[model samples]
Target: MVDRYVAAVDQGTTSTRCILFDHAGRLAAVAQREHRQHLPRPGWVEHDAQEILRNVLRVVGEAVQDVGAGPGQVVALGIANQRETTVLWDPRTGQPYGHAVVWQDLRTEARVEELAADGGRDRFRDVCGLPLTTYFAGPRIAWLLDATPGLRDAAAAGHVLFGTVDSWLVWNLTGGPDGGVHVTDVTNASRTMLMDLAGRHWSPALCEAMGVPMQILPEIRSSAEVYGLTGGPVAEVLPGVPVAAALGDQQAALFGQTCFAPGEAKCTYGTGSFVLINTGATPVTAEHGTLPTVAYQIGDEPAAYALEGAIAVTGSLVQWFRDGLGMIATAPDIEGLALSVPDNGGCYIVPAFSGLFAPHWRPDARGVVVGLTSFVTRAHLARAVLEATAWQTRDVVDAMDADSGLRLTSLRVDGGMTSNNLLMQTVADVLGVPVVRPMVSETVSLGAAYAAGLAVGWWPDLEGLRRNWHRAGEWLPHADPAAVARGHEDWTRAVQHSFGWSREPSSHDGGAPSAQPGR
Candidate 1:
């Protein structure tokens, strides 16, 4: 690879992004486009798969131009994406059957309950390292097959193909219908509930249970591997440039945050918040409700495991405050607005905007604000929103610690929400551990760069990657532990009240609730 630059695609739920990072891991430029969010029914969300592809191309071209770097300087291209967004399309024409079933879509709650009632959910989770829910791809794939006409037959006849965003992009970039490599990284595949956690292959039992054809699935590959070359319309930028690495965005962020050692964890605050603890090369099965996931897989090496806590809301609540309610003029203004009030004023906000996840595992919960009084102003409401995220994060941390038997020395945080000083401060106070902020907030892409750079010798190894990690700041708790403890109790109470609240979509049909956006 002659070039020192890498083009990293970080596609998310609300937007598609492309960023350029040099070999030294410095940010060069970024291009992003917010696409349409379709809510065909309450609690259900979808995105056009083809529009996502279009946004990717536009953003990639723009980012390259911004840095005066194009495909030629892009030594390698790496992909990191929102895991569990299931895509199904015509193999012959490369056209999607309909919108992509977003991770936030809640259309399969009743179906999940049906599986659980049948006694198959428990057995599958034991083998797959994931629970039976709409949060994973297997269920979404099943939903698409059962809801869409001819999809089942098409999949069976090998006329349709299934993939997460990584597989979709690879197929489009490498010649789409003409023929692109069909592959998914182990990280993304892990969220599908179809891949064996230990063997890392599509499990026959899981597929049969979900009623999906194995032929439609992509071959799972290691996180860091040269998948193939670009061959489609966008090939002019850098034809035959190797696609070196691929990872689920959260896993990429974990690597990018330099959490290479066991027990090291990071929480990425975005539309939703996910906390992942790296437990290198050993599947640390959690007896306590946390999930065991593959952090990353390299070559034939043993897979790294993680204990994950999935929260539905984080920054989006703040977005709602600004856009939906007009509580604040802008998102960044939330920090000051929240800080304007000394506390939540005895109020607790349970942001189960879609539903609650992990520890509680309740699909019936909805967003609620408890302990409200006339004295509570918008500032207090703002503060409650920020505090709620911290409290929810602590819940995950506590569960992870209980399950893994590892006390966290500090919690590493990244993503757009981490930029808020007040939120970070509150998070530190609540977690009772120092919150370490990295110099590069875009750890998602950096993780992709780390894996891809290591693949082609741009990086010598994990040690070199850690040595180059740049930490920006650290925040520690300065408040009374007792007060924080009381605040946590209040938050839990608010969570309970959030349940059976009105106006939130519970399920697609009548099963376990779909995992919606947490904010």
Candidate 2:
């Protein structure tokens, strides 16, 4: 019998990757390419949609050829993408209006503040399960329509279309500009702040409030289904293969980690860190600042819900240490440097580079390194950098406990940062729970593949996929509880110093002060 495989496209913040997985959920082949990040102005981040599309095609072709897989052997394709990255494009040419506004972009911060002034940030929480913030797509869409000349009128008239990265990839893969399917999965839609939590559809009230036209939005669909088949440019690689699934990267990690039951949780550490717990069928209202979101939906069955805590900067902080400060040659070197020191030496770093997310939701906060003294060395700073990510994870875990009234017993972890043994130990010590990693560290891609395979009947069911998962490593808390508590207290103090560093200008104000460019 011929071997069959499921392919997944992981379009992340930094790069685009294609991976082929075998029946055992092990990676058969992989290919990746980095796209350029465009920073046109201060607080603005963009990506060329055309470049991303081209990269996706290149990687897909490369991955398939790498394993020498036959044409029909690659059975299905799934997309796991960075959510809330807004793309507006012309349907006629299938060309983007401009660069895509990344989730980390703060260009919409002023508009978000304006909207929140009326009813506070949580005004939309009851309906959409999201707070008013620049992290979502609604405010970004509104800003694009207003800033671009004649865009509002065009969008309102249905001349332009709006989508997150998943929709963009799906539309292009199916058949861009020639009967391409324009739709978004519930997981991605839930991050836009324009979808009703209960109805699982676009909310009219949110459209009007965000100044977005209902016509421009994509049709919301389930996470696992055949949206369309590969056609157009994508046909060159995997012709007629079903595009079976679409999921936000973090949710993909959750699914990949096999966190199918309620109370099961996973944390993915990448450009950012996201902690999501499966909360069963019903959406849980988060009182502690975590956001309720759709985990996944299969066919016509009810959607599974999750509570997510998003931390804006985790692995990116390491990137800054390597690139910005030239402190180390590469990202992995931080672990070696940090190990040279016994501890942080009373130092702490709050990486609020693009302002904080989750729990605090403070866009005014800036990155701060506190407790700096003559005794602190570069090694101590490296340790502090790693500790920052651990402390942020602890904050979210605490919030999750408060909202659900259940303590997390263990955490399933993945992403590039998990390769650092010291970092994993730090996370376990800080959270007072065991940190576990699966044999397949690429849970984001594996999750996408699992959904795709299930849709095409390539896999039996969720239980079959769960059986494929195997434990790779585990870290247990060894630090003194009293010492950890004191460190957390000091970390909280350092976080407070980061707040109120940047003030949002009011509409009545004549002008705001000029700001420096961000990383």
Candidate 3:
């Protein structure tokens, strides 16, 4: 008998990857390709949707071939994408109007401020469970509609279609411009600021406020269901496989980590770091800066809610260090450079490169490296870079505790950055809890595969998926409490220096002039 597998495509900030998972939740094979990041202007980031889709096809084919599996041997395909990367396309031609606005792009910052001017950022918090931040799809869509001539009119007439990356992939995969299914999962829709949290449908008032047309929206579906099948261009690789699930990459990580119960939490440290705590059936209001979001929804089941603390700079900070500064030869080299120093040498780096997120949603803030002195060396700066991510996670954990009213005892961690032992230990030390990595580190793809498999009855249930989780490594808190408190206080002081540094209008163009040295 041939072994069956579930395939998942993880459309990330900087790359697209396809992974195959066996029934026991073990990774069978994987293929990935990085797409170009277009930064036309300061504080702007865009991606060619066409390039991403092509890479998706290539990676999918490569992953399947790597496993020596035929299309029939693959049970289902799922998608986990970088949420809020907005794409608007002409359904007639299956062509995007422009590049997809990345979640990290702050080009919509002015629009966000204008919307929040009257009602403040929490104006639509009750309706959408999201603040008016540049990190969502709504403002980006609005900006595109306004910036592009006749786009609003086209959208109203149903000539244009709006979706996050998941909807885009599913549409094209099923059969773009050839009777493709246009739909978005509840998890991805929840991040759009156009969906009603309780109702689990598009909020009419939000669509009007964001200048988005209801006609352009996709049919909102559950995270796990047979939405469509690979029929069009996708047929060349995954022909006729059930497209079973879709999720925001962070939410996918939560599901992938098997945090199925209330108060259970996971943090994915990727391009950005997101800490999500399962709040169960009820959507927890954002009282403490954490965004309430749909974790995942099975077929017809009530949507599971999570409180998320989104940090905009974690792994990307490392990328900037490598590419922007040429400080290290590679991303992983920073770990060894950091270990060369016993400590941060009284330095702290608050990586608010595109402003801070979570606990402090200060868009005006910029990255800052403080406590710098002549005594500090390049090695110390590397240590400070790693510590910045740990401190940010600590901030989110604190906020999650307040919002959910549940203390995080231990955190299930995943993503590329988790492999750094120093960073993992720093996270455990900062949070005073055990930081644990699962045997399978690619939880985003795994979660998508798990949901897909569950939908197709390949996996028994959540209990079985939970049993597949095995610990690969663990880091425990080892720092002195008093010393840790002092360090945190200093870090907080450094964070304060980042705020109010970019208050002027043109300052939003990119990082503050003062932040240039740090970057």
Q: Which 10-residue window of candidate 3 scores lowest in summed lDDT?
A: 510-519
TM-score, cand. 1: 0.91
lDDT of 3 by residue, 1-519 (tens): 898899999998889999999999989999999999999998788999999999999999999999899858999999999888899999999999999888777788778778777687778988988767677888889899999999988887889999999999999999999988999999999988999998999999998888777888999999999988898877987888999999988899999999999989998887777789998898987687787999999998788999988787888889988999899999999999999989999999898876677778776888888888999998999999999999999988898888888888899998888889999999999999999999998899999999999999999899999999999999999999998899999999999999888766642322112111110
Q: Which is superior by TM-score, 2 or 3? A: 2
Query: Which runs in model 1 stand beyond 4 Å of their true positions?
Result: 1-3, 70-72, 120-123, 323-326, 372-378, 500-513
Over 68-180, each residue of candidate 2 has an lDDT whose tens digit, in order, gives: 88789999999999889999999988999999999878798788778888887777889998777677899899899999999988886677999999999999999999989
- Candidate RMSDs in Å, in order, are 2.9, 3.5, 3.5
TM-score of each model, paired residue for residue: 0.91, 0.91, 0.91
lDDT of 1 by residue, 17-91 (tens): 888888778888899999999899987889999999999888988887787764467777888888889999897
**lDDT per model, in order?**
0.83, 0.89, 0.88
Local error of candidate 3 at residue 54 (angstroms): 2.0
Show the lowest summed lDDT stretch of 10 residues, model 2.
510-519
> Model 1 misses residue 498 by how many Å?
3.3
- Candidate 2 positional error at 281, Å: 1.3
Model 2 / residue 49 / CA error / Å? 1.7
